[model samples]
Target: MMDKMMATLLESLHEATQRLEQAVAVKESNPDDWLAILDEREELIHQMQERFSAGSVLTEAQRVQLTQIYEVNQRLIPLIEGCKQGVQQQLNNLHRSKLAMNSYNEAGPNGYGAFFDRKK
Candidate 1:
């Protein structure tokens, strides 16, 4: 039988995983919300590690629950990677546009040309 702390941590992990799934399912999910869920999951995992590393063994059910969490994570990896790539592409495009604008401004006609008016 799992200890109470372990059970609670596992339940929290399960809930975090559900939130992650929902976040991934939405096409326009907020990255901040997804990241918050991930952060919560990481904290729960750390808590579980601290609690379980004291020469404790997991019961079969606990092992199964962990395995399920692992499976869900595996499935999410590709989707997460895709999202990362999309964001990276957007950043790259923005950077290129900024550089182009900067170059254009640098090569542009400065106000010096307008200062010496021919009709002055």
Candidate 2:
């Protein structure tokens, strides 16, 4: 039974890492992917909680590996949050840049050459 539990945890760990990698991959492409990663992270935590409740019967190796995962995730969640913030900031900056360029065009030059001439 303990071995089974350990196996489950190991499997969960593997799946969680894969999910994390996927999240990172799609992070720049879509916000939905990041949200999915958050969900997966929660699921992984819940699995750990369930296993912990079942018993402290984990093998030394399992325990060590689990502890490492826990620590790594403790750092990783913050990094993910930072990534999300960065994506948001980049989107906002792009929007603002577009708006500024539009306003500049409306005010005078409608073309890049015209704007460059005005700048000189």
Model 2: CA > 4 A from native: 1-3, 22-29, 74-79, 94-120
- Candidate 1 residues lying further than 4 Å off, grouped into runs, are 110-120
Residue 60, model 2: lDDT of: 77
lDDT of 2 by residue, 1-120 (tens): 466765776767766766675566564556676567668767866777776786746777777877777676676677778787897999999999999887666675445454443543
Task: Give the TM-scores of the predictions, in the order they appear.
Answer: 0.84, 0.54
Clashes of each: 0, 0
In model 2, pairs of residues that clash are none
Candidate 1 per-residue lDDT, tens place, 1-120, comes to 458888888989988998898899788898899999999999999988898786556788988988999999998889989998999999999999999777666664657555322322
